[model samples]
Target: MRVPLALLMIATPLAAAKRPTVAQLQIQVKKLTEERDSLKQRLAATDSLQQDLVAAQQARDQAKADADAARKEVEQLKANLKANASGGDTLLKDLEAARKEAEASREELAKVKAENAELRQQVAAAPREGDLVMLTRDVQPARPLNLNRATPHIKASGFFASRPTGVVVVNVLVSEKGEVLDARLLQGLPGDSPDAKAANEACVQSAKNLVFDPATSKDGNTRFKVWQGVGFYLD
Candidate 1:
């Protein structure tokens, strides 16, 4: 018997198949759908992880840069501290040296002051040594009594009726050539009274009028600066 072509085609698929269970087909379809969803989730998770790693690396790089800047600043501070310490030491040494110099100057000034005081004392103690030496050389020898010198300046008026009236003392400095340089009354009656003034004047005149033999030194040379004191006594 000859079969139709359409029926042959349909019958051919049926002849090759073992009969399929409906439960097995359903299980296979479920397994394939789960595998596709699992693949999509894994891809999304990988992308998120890559993004987090990049942010962490950027933070680490910034921290490293900040650490380098801090280290440089610390080094600079250390250098500045060392420089200041050295300068302070130098200043201390200079101060000590200046102190010593000032002390020495003060000591020297004290020594100078002491020397000046001693010099002033010496000057005050012996004021007239030079004057005395000159006077000694000028004293004339008035001894050996030349009493017969007929005096024109002295006259006896039959001796005074009353006790002689006036007495005076005068000091005179004779110049180098034996001329009276100065005459002054040292002690006498005090007054503007004519009698007292006359007496004083007379004494001064007498001193000036008197002449001495030229004074001589031990070597017989004429001396300078003779001084004399003349006293007028009433008896």
Candidate 2:
């Protein structure tokens, strides 16, 4: 009986060790549930972090695109400015050329006016047909008269003396006796002003007083008409 009792005691202890208590089983189940919840929260945090990374990458790309656009715009503006500068320079050169052309035209106009005046003078001095003879120092006359002797007869008014040097052309008719038949003013100063009229009358009167040799034609006719120029000089 004692031996069976000892064996029974050993068997009882072994059974208690093999089977778990109710309270210890509940603690293990609670621990396993808490571990599962912690793992779920970590997965959620990883997903949110991935989404944030994607958003950051998109923003960076957008900023890069905007910067590139700005740089391109700046380059375009620079090109436009350079083109405008070149155009401005060309316009300035064209203006300078135009000014030079205008100056040359003015000079040419002045030259033409001078040439026209000289031509007028030459036309006035030219000889016409039907003249008896051209009176020169070389031609000997029947009775020579000094033209300088008539200088005292020339009358100068205050108005005529105030003007610049001028000229008067006269036509003179002489008789066979070397007497002046008529004297007329061919051309005088340009205007018909009082000064011009006085100058013309005074020159005509002086020319009428002038004594000259009888000018003859080739046939020795003792009548002639002569055109002469007289200059009025200011002292």
Candidate 3:
């Protein structure tokens, strides 16, 4: 059928407008592909980030465990050091106490030695007399009549000058070193004489050489500490 020319021309322009060009279609396909690929890449990157986060968390846990172990070790070391320090302090205190005790013992020993030395000197410095006899000790205790005839004469000089006139009493204690330690007047004679003191001194001097009989316990034995009183007068 024959178409009108004006209608054909308008229909031809409409068809041309509806159809797309090759270059424009290609551009649109490229843009759509790029957008799909970009979305896939973004999902992959998100997964990688999740894995990194998990690894970091694990590392943090391990670090915490290591720190705890280190802390425990330090605490144990501190405890050990404290114990050692306390033990050392006790040992040092014991050593000091021992040293002080040793010093005190040394001082006591020195004091004992000094006392022994003094006793020795006293014994060595005592007077010596061989000619003088121990008349009172040697005389027979039962019968003693002659006063002037005694070997060691008891002279009535000094405080008892009235010879053979009155009686005098004296107290005496002898030491271990054969020396007169104490002498005192128990009673004085009535006469004004220095003889009593002289007689006492003579007795004391003669008593120094008095030999003692061996002593024993409760058994019947000769005793050493012997005491006697004597009186001398002119006939």
Candidate 4:
């Protein structure tokens, strides 16, 4: 009862799968068509995206131009501000200079006023012209009046022309060099007549011609100023 190997092999069936039905094949075809339509929709969206990118680039260029213009405007404003500041500083300096000048002018005016007051005081304290004020006793020369070398110079012709009959005294201020610097009439005639005035002027003139010795201090050595009197008795 042993069978042949070839006949046993033929009796064993192969493990092959069954074939697909027609309806299943139709469902697969439908899915592949839907995928193709979705791919077409995505490809159409790429053109719109490209247009948006172009618009964005144009907007970016316009924004850059606006920013440049704004920057230039800001720079101009800064320059203007700096110029105004310079002008303000110059104005302040000018004001300060004017104030200093005013102060100087005020000081000068004060000095002028002080000088005027001093001059007025000096004028009040000075002696008047033709005053016969004698030197103080302490400062007078040793011989205040020296009649020697004075009588020879007197003449009758000086007062005789006026026909005056009075004594005329003249105050002569003698320098240390025995020179007569000034002569003033101390005593004249009793009346103020024309002849009396003439006689007084003649006496003053004659007194100036008189010579004298050098004046000395109380110690009789130091040269000093002195005053002398010359009398003219006219008849």
Model 3 lDDT per residue over 119-210, tens place: 45643552232111111223211122232233235444346334443333333332322333454443344544465555445444433333
- Write candidate 1's Cα lDDT for 121-155 as tens digits: 64354323112222232334221121123111322
**Per-residue CA lDDT of candidate 2, range 1-235, in tens?**
0001110001122225668743344344334433443354345434654565555455545545554554555455556656788676655555455455545545554554565565456435533333333343432332326554443223335543544234454545555556667777655657776656766676677667767666554455434443333322211
C-alpha positional error of residue 16 in candidate 3 after TM-score superposition, expressed in Å: 99
Which has the greatest lDDT?
4
lDDT of each: 0.43, 0.47, 0.38, 0.49
Count clashing pairs, candidate 3. Answer: 14
Off by over 4 Å in 1: 1-166, 190-192
RMSD of 3: 68.7
The TM-scores, one per candidate, come to 0.33, 0.32, 0.24, 0.36
Q: What is the TM-score ranking, best to worst? A: 4, 1, 2, 3
**Tens digit of lDDT per residue, candidate 4, span 34-146?**
34423443344345545655554555455455545545554554566567876766545554554555455455545545655654564355333333222433333323233
